[model samples]
Target: MNLLNCHQINELLSAYLENELDTTTTLTVANHLEKCLSCEKELKALTNVSNLVKTVIREADKTDLSLVARSNKINSLVKDEITSKIKATENLVLASSNDNSIKTSQNNIVKLNLRPKWSALSKKIFLSLAASVAIICLSLFTITYYATSTGPLLSGVARNHQFCSAIEISNIGWHKGYPKERLLQANNINLPKLDTLGVHFSDLHPCKVYKAPFLHMMYSKGDKQISLYYGSQEAVNKFQEKFKTITPNELYLHQESNLQIAAISTQKNNLWIVAGDLTKEEINAITSELAINSLSNTEESKLFH
Candidate 1:
């Protein structure tokens, strides 16, 4: 047969082997197979290959149990390894949590221990400041109280004796008047000739007119000038008693009208006998001088005489 003619016969043979051919085609293929030795050999070889494939499938089916067992073992091992890793992570987290809790507790304890000492130091500082403030306030109060009580008495003295002049006139002939000059001659007390000690008459005031050792003495000191009737020791004592509230260590001499007279001794023994209507200003000035102790006893006698 021609090769082209064998095309259909090959299809028939393939179909016949699978039992897909009709009865007529099966007989035709069988008849052709009996006559065609090449086709018959090809069919036999295809059959033998199919049988061998079936045998291999049967063997694979039989060994499937072994494969399933090995797969199950591998799955179990992976699960165990995963669980162990999870447990190890959980233990590490627990340990870290415990350490953090312990650290926080320690910090709290340290703060608590320091709190009392800090509080005590704060209290001590506050109390010390309070005490210092209290002491300063008390001292200021005492000073103010004393100044208020004493200020008025000093002011009153200044107001009463506001008209006197502050000048010193000693052993001057013109101050004695003409008739008093005759009395000075009779007493045998030689009087100095009248001359200004560059001191003005306005600077002189009649503080006191004295007899015996000194007579008709009109004393004048700064801002105060007055004429006094200085008769006897009895008169001076009567004046002192009337002004009994005068300050101690203050030398009281005489008074003319409302004016009061006092003398203080300096270091030079000089007497600063101030007579004033403004007694406070005068006394303040005198006290300032006294602080330095400059007016001594010798200076006191020269001013007094």
Candidate 2:
């Protein structure tokens, strides 16, 4: 037969477990599994997941649903069909073990008879159950991932601004780490000079906003300080989604402690946040200016090139 890569083997694993592959392909997969540890581990994990889903389905049938008489009757019929299939599979495995004509390998691959073809109604029920399982799995994965990544970065940005603003008022100098120009160029962010808006750049330090790199630019207008934070689109999208109240380029307004904050995306979709001890109007103005200026710079660069 043919040599199958890990990805190919994975694609066949479900069918192989179901005794749906022809004998030659089944033997090939078995041989591959004996020699390949990664594919073997994957097969084991898939088996566990499959068994878990089956157990969940079985337990679901045991739930009391007497109030909904029609649904209860349907669940009863489905449970009976599933139980019969499980018993038939067990019997087939036992018969395979006892058959003298069947060949067995050292890796415990015993060929079994093909599964009996399902009736049309049986196929529909099985497919509907499979679809429900798939939907549940996808929803769980999305919720877990979103919860871990979003809803915290905005608070982190606000806290960073508050801490740094206090230090700036004390006349403390920021640590000069990476040069500002190189950082901006590497990240493809345009930090516009806000002299027109009375916000003058005071200092910039490279800092981590959660797990992503952020260019934290400090600005001053007399005694008032403003923070302009720029980071990647991926990081900012999560923060924006947490608020669930902004269009593509609209600003998200938030506050932490005494610091008022605003965030918006540039026309190029890069994220920018403006935060300070200012009113809603001031924070919104600074955020809009940064976004508009950054958008203009992007267009200008494209035109110049």
Candidate 3:
């Protein structure tokens, strides 16, 4: 049977825990765990954590839906009322039939008064509920806006990939430590023979991803470019959960019209992402060659960057 290394073994842990891997892979992982203490600990940790999460979610699933449904009913009614009031607020003519209730015009014009003429208790309840909904919606919109603009470096990388020439290699200032030093700093291996892709190495820039410092490198190939981003675990953990986790151990590839991102986590939990607009062939070629060879063939495919 073929033995699996830590990287390949790590990817199989989730599936192995659930008994989803094929029989050969399962046996291989079991044999590997017996000899590899580090892989063994990591597997146990991940398994314990996953089981705990599953248990919590299972308990949460058992929660009575009637309670949720009742609350949702209240929110839904308020949302509808708010929607009507908002439409009414936009009308050219704003008038209220009575200060107590919401009223609408035949021609899409509606009248909404904050101080409703309804009875004292009910009126207060409606106003309070409306105010709460307003607060919730406002908060959500604010959060969404903030999240989109928060990652300027990441956003810029994504955006720049869309353009032909967003910046000169000099403008980004990639220089600093030697390639060996930068690779060491990131706890990753630099790919040899990247010249096959016509890469012009840029200086390693000191940067932050969500305020965690990491070195950034850019490689220009004519008008096209790609970025290899490194970030510590804590900072990178805040990214989309889907991107953070992967089914396969190799560099996980995600493509967009503007960019193609190949992101993976190192053994130390540091994140290394390579993004560009290369074709499937180019991406596969780059990823295949990106990692430095490990001591054994089993760990050869594990890419730190």
Candidate 1 lDDT, tens digit per residue, 1-305? 22324457777766888999888778877887888888888789878988899999999888788877888999999999999997886665556653533333544431112134478889999999999999988865554333222224224433322322211222322232336546545433323211232112221222222212223333344444432222234334433455555543254444433445564333222223344343555555544544443322323322222
Tell me the tens digit of each residue's lDDT in model 2 across 1-305.
68789899999999998999999999999999999999999999999999999999878876856648988889999999999998996777776776654656899776664444456679999999999999988875554334322235333433345422212111122244546787678777667778988889877765545444567788888888778777676656545455555443333445433555555556444666676667666765676677576756432111101
lDDT scores for all predictions? 0.46, 0.65, 0.58
Quality of model 3 by C-alpha lDDT: 0.58
TM per candidate: 0.21, 0.37, 0.34
Q: List where candidate 3 sits over 4 angstroms from the true fold.
A: 1-193, 210-212, 240-257, 265-268, 293-305
lDDT by residue (1-305, candidate 3, tens digit) is 49566898998888988899999989999999999999999988997898899999988877867777888999999999999987776652345434446656688655555663557889789999999999988875554434322234235443432311222122232323444464544544443346776776754454444444455566778887777665566645644343434422333445323455665444445555666766666665665555532112323223332
Task: Give the top-scoring candidate (TM-score).
Answer: 2
Please give the lDDT score for candidate 2.
0.65
Over the full model, what C-alpha lDDT does candidate 1 score relative to the true structure? 0.46
Least accurate stretch of 10 residues (summed lDDT) in model 1? Answer: 192-201
**Which candidate, 2 or 3, would have the higher TM-score against the true structure?**
2
Candidate 2 lDDT for residue 13: 95
> lDDT, candidate 2, residue 293?
69
